[model samples]
Target: MNEDPGRDVEQEEEELFEHYRFKVDPGQELVRIDKYLIDRLPNTSRNKIQSAARNGSVVVNGKSVKSNYKVKPKDEVAIVLPYPVREIELIPQNIPLDIIYEDDQLIVINKPADMVVHPGYGNYTGTLVNALVYHFDNLPERKSDYYGRPGLVHRLDKHTTGIMVVAKTEDALTNLAKQFYDRTTERRYHALVWGDVEEDMRIEGNLGRSFQNRKVMTVFPEGDHGKHAVTHVKVLKRFGLVTLVECKLETGRTHQIRTHLKWKGHPLFHDLEYGGDRIVRGTTHDKYKQFIHNCFELIPGQALHAKSLGFQHPKTHEWMQFDSELPQGFQELLNKWERYVTE
Candidate 1:
């Protein structure tokens, strides 16, 4: 039950590194380290492996090595590099963006649901990055020349709506990144959960990729696995069957709010990944079931929104805050619930 002081939260704006390890066979012949990795790491090229070496990411037998260094028998090779398995070309597409604020150093956006933040795996296009590429003419070019991502200081889930910031300059990027890393930024989410929440509460746990489902996160109550996460919640309104709540994140782990709320026994309404799509509470009458089903249909996914954000201006060092209204569907769903409870 002990908690580590260090928390693990994945900000979408931050670059994620993929970790790799390889142990050379005892009888393996010496060969160029770069060539050795090219055969082992799928889709990676010689140039990319060499670049990783130059960045001190590639190690052999516990020491960083040059790409041309010989791989000896029993050598243990490891690397940590930005993910995507391979480079991808970023194409600027003329997608619409709901821009909230913009300056020479950064841009703020009120993102909509159903838009992936950046491209990866099956989602290589139609993301916020593609739209950003088309929208902004002067994005800061990364020093590492990493492909396909830009300007992002943090990200929202594809199905989650809310405010986000993007950096426009290298200095802005660095300083903004530091702010997020130091946990100085403020983020608030509005979530409609399946059951009435009577009291305000704080939830804490270690969050990690679910061992049973790699696609989603799970809570490790013992704090022995995953990264530490904390969320504070206040009930905003109460329907006998459901509750509207505001969640403030202390750590932004991937799916932190969703998973922690699930562990707290109040998974968000219509949260398909965490089994909130079903009638977790309320009357078992067919009418009630049908009404719940209809509510689920109104919102495309989980009824959660990143309603507000606060952070220091990366350049001016001024305190900046922004808020967004709930999306149309979320408002409509809540209205329906209010009517249901009153009637």
Candidate 2:
């Protein structure tokens, strides 16, 4: 499995409701499943395991089991549970949000680039969550089993600009979270990548953090490691050496699009982590190199935008879709590319 840099297994698992599997040792003695799990799973409490078992979330040998069930030798055990919560003081900051739509149930915002979605280790202030708590009251905070991100059902990377939907009430939070987890929500991203992608294609692979570089994700084509992820790419426009494509996610793993596209021989322009910051498909001329450098300077990070989002409204059950214009920097970069191609 891929590991997020600077985060432990528990933290990573808790970021989303995750499925965990364990194999009882052949030489192991009989023990209550909940107690056994409490020992094996770090930071997870006995009450949480028991609750999951009572809810039929714990399974052994293909059948659901109660917390009192004794785990047998060579038993295949699996459980579904949300990540444990970390106690951190959430300080609300008076940061302005670009609200796209808001109602009693939810709020949608056009997130700007370079803004971290939530506060974490090195990012303790100026986060979208900080802004959220300041601007909105009674926002549903994720349960202890889920990540501690208030009102957030999903997230975007710090440098990735896009649209995000925030839940205002618990019902809305649960419903929206379920939609995202079930892959029922629609999310489309526009990305500028190095290389001229010849045709539309689907990229399927297992994504995991690289052992060599803990901060960057890598594709495991053999499926031997990591979580399964899929991204569909459709060419929108081409700029000789680089291409703009629409990426539709079939599964939303961490850094899924960036990792998948990199594995497919196309990295987003100026994506420093994925090697797109350097010239990968361009000429050796000094003038071309300088032009590429100038282009990179226009964006804070990778040339990717979360342009559209669609989901069912929890309160009304109505299908809702929202589209966002590209950020000014991204638009200007595209304009520069167009001008270069035309000239």
Candidate 3:
């Protein structure tokens, strides 16, 4: 139940989008309004959240307020989110899409490195979802504000390039997302990391948020909020200082492969976030921007590539797979590394 102590119910529903009602507890005290919005709506972007609060969509104790407004415990707040339509009208443009495989139910796309899977803060216009919006005749209803991102079952690092699957229908979305939850979907990444891995090493660790930064994930011993993560590393080739390795994902945690590799002392080169920059650039340093890219070379971003994807077809129950070759950029770096090792 919620407080309808003051305003009209129908008008309120039409006026504000926060249909998910909430009451502030006395224990959860004195936090900023924008942050409260985040806690309330996990799917909405921070930028949209701030704007909604500023525009007076947020009411504390039945009073409109700004994003920076702070509140004490036991505050009563009402929030409204933008109306969610069953189907949103998204204009499709003729953007380049790397089609790995396609069927009636799903599409396997070799997402480029620089391309975003969905839209959010600092990224709105140019995203995989935006392209997909135009690619499909209709998109299914979004579950949350992250709705801007449609039919996306998994995500690659903004810098890490790899294979991604886009669902064409609601049924496909359900089947694919469930596959990930059940750990049935198979994903593999090719990382040209710096330094040699210690002979086909298997590094397994629990992952959770970093203590120093809330924005980054870190490896930790068994503890609160930590999820069990398993990654398999196989040495593909050794290049003196750098080694090209293939990573297999058992559990898809945020940045699981990258974070695990970094923890295992064989960080991918040019990885500024989790220890990739430490690798010594042998000779050719000025050739590429970042070292991660998507599965195929169709996009731009990082040196990590999604080389392959395997899954049981949701509808057909047939075993299917898609393989993407390393982008020329990644190959070029490997060549230079090989040359450096030779000379």
Name the candidate that leads on TM-score.
2
lDDT of 3 by residue, 114-135 (tens): 6666555555567777787666
Task: State each model's CA lDDT, in order.
Answer: 0.78, 0.81, 0.65
lDDT per residue for candidate 2 within 235-285, as digits (tens), equals 999999889999998888888888889888999999978998999987899
Native-to-model Cα distance after best TM-score fit, residue 265 in candidate 3, in Å: 1.2
CA RMSD, predictions in order: 8.6, 5.5, 13.4
Candidate 3 Cα outliers beyond 4 Å, as residue runs? 1-91, 138-149, 280-302
Candidate 2 TM-score, true structure as reference: 0.78
- Residue by residue across 56-165, what tens digits does model 1's lDDT show? 66888888898899998988998754434124577788888999998777889988888888766677789888888777644454333323345566778878998988
Model 1: CA > 4 A from native:
1-86, 138-149
Error of 2 at 57 (Å): 11
TM-score each candidate: 0.74, 0.78, 0.66
Candidate number with the higher TM-score (1 or 3): 1
| Most accurate candidate by lDDT | 2
Task: List, in order, the clash count of every candidate structure.
Answer: 2, 1, 21
Worst 10 residues of 1 by lDDT: 1-10
Worst 10 residues of 2 by lDDT: 8-17
Q: Candidate 1 deviates by what RMSD?
A: 8.6
Report the lDDT of model 3 for residue 143: 30
